[model samples]
Target: MRRLACAPDTRPLISDRNHLGALAYCYATREEDCLPYRTARDFYARRVAPELPETVLTAILLVSPGRSLTRRGNVAELPRGKQWFDEGLPERLHHFCTDIAPSLCPTPPTVINTDGATPETVLAQVAGVLADAGLDQTAQRLASATAHAPRPPLDPRFVDTYTQLGGLEAFGHPFTPPIAHRGGTVQLCRLGAPHHDPAGHTRLWNPLGPGPWPPPGPAWSR
Candidate 1:
């Protein structure tokens, strides 16, 4: 037992419920729902955390309320995979942010709210925090740095809407890269979604329009 504890190469065991996922369920509609999560949180702090590394930092991620509710509704409408969601998810998320997550660590946990953001943006915040904690991973930094890079070759309009308008920055950071759909290309960003036609003409798109994102195409069709 002494030799095993002295091992430097040991990796931390990860349990999905070890973190915020448990406290989240604690806010569910019933008292019975709270017990398991409360017990799990207590066990981890008492039994698991001591055996693990003394250094600990918790990073809590939250989605924007608008998107969270939208995705929640979307998931509910799916014909299958209903088990992953519940009507109370929004309330739980809110409670975690306002009530529970703030009091977690002796020092506050780094909380990043992912509202109208690309995966890279959210990941960048996490990587930046970990770097400060003296544990830096090269791949994660590279991923966040290149999040806006065009996957397939970029179209002229996809990069620059007009010569006088400078570049894609005017449309905000790229979310999904320029993807080939039907024949041309489509890309989504914070401000707009743009489409490139087969005829070398590009058209502006409203991503928030009443349809699948990236405008209508065989791939995105309902």
Candidate 2:
């Protein structure tokens, strides 16, 4: 007898009331029912085809609640072989499904509900939540990104470069704080550097640069 260990399904549960009507249609319908209309291969086609309607594609995005319920006792016993089990795989999958997938949607949903609160207020609330979770750096970055201010706690070397580029006033603002890229950390200023032309947008500042600023022109400008 062979024992098989399967990972738990951590997919979000879909409620009939929560999903759109078109999605609900597919979710409620059984795969066997869909097979009569379309083959399994055709139903799971990646690109839009004459056979696959837009509504069907949208419906495919919804998690099928039935699959979760039906998979309880079914397990495949594989022949003896080296099996690799990663404890962290489930958490990574959860992050991708819950966090990354939503963001990758054509129109990503808003972070918070749109109540009477202003955009600034909502951002502040998010920052506060991050701070409460002991993510001080993330909270600071969120606040800085929203305010369009210089990224706080700048390194000693970049301080002079930031001041020379007219700080927040002339450079517009620090849209992205310094983050590690390629070989060195780079910061993105909303306005281009002084050497670039008028149409130039987004100046790149890297502490590891041969000089203080990135090269002029579109190639190195981004």
Candidate 3:
């Protein structure tokens, strides 16, 4: 059974409540209700319409010390597929906005890079972007709500909207999209629900566990 995953934001109404509403929506609809890994694989084969919002409705930038980039092996390390995504995906994502999304929206995405900026600076930038996007009220509400947001331990599979606005170092590793799984023959797949094999789960979870991360770097850091 194919599933459609959405990135929340349904209740874009109440100013103070909307940001959390959107997050709850995304968490409930996309992460909890829909299976993104399976859906992405299905998308690869079928070339279906993207389940997430089309266009760079917003561009969330994460800036960190070059050390953070080295630490995370580059933000590109987060996207699924392509061995080179770790090296190339950031540019690719940028291109997607500049080249691909313009056809769909009058306004381009609002980009935020918090490489050396403070939280207040980051928040101001986010507010500016939202204001430019004609979402000032929404941005104001989010600014307040995010300040009080109770952070959960990082889940590498879950994308953090806050991280996109900078402060990734404080949030721990940013959770990214997971690689999709393509099961074997149709007959072999039916023995149980089509899902990731054991190895696939390991690859997906490796970044989150305590250990030496593959490809090697600092042996003493979290």
lDDT of each: 0.49, 0.36, 0.37
lDDT of 1 by residue, 128-188 (tens): 6655655455325634575555544334554434223333333444556566767966665
Lowest summed lDDT across 10 adjacent residues in model 2 is found at 76-85
RMSD of candidates 1 onward, in order: 14.9, 22.0, 15.6
TM-score of 3: 0.35
User: What value of lDDT does candidate 1 attain over all alpha carbons?
Assistant: 0.49
Q: Candidates' TM-scores? A: 0.47, 0.25, 0.35
Stronger candidate by TM-score (1 vs 3): 1
- Measured by TM-score, the strongest candidate is 1
**Candidate 2 local Cα displacement, residue 115, angstroms:** 6.2
Q: Where is the poorest 10-residue window by lDDT in model 1?
A: 1-10
Between candidates 2 and 3, the one scoring higher on TM-score is: 3
By TM-score, the candidates rank as 1, 3, 2
Residue-level lDDT tens digits of model 2 in 57-170: 111122222332233222312111001012232233333344543432233322333245555766576566455445567568767665434454544446666666445444
Q: lDDT of model 3 at residue 14?
A: 19
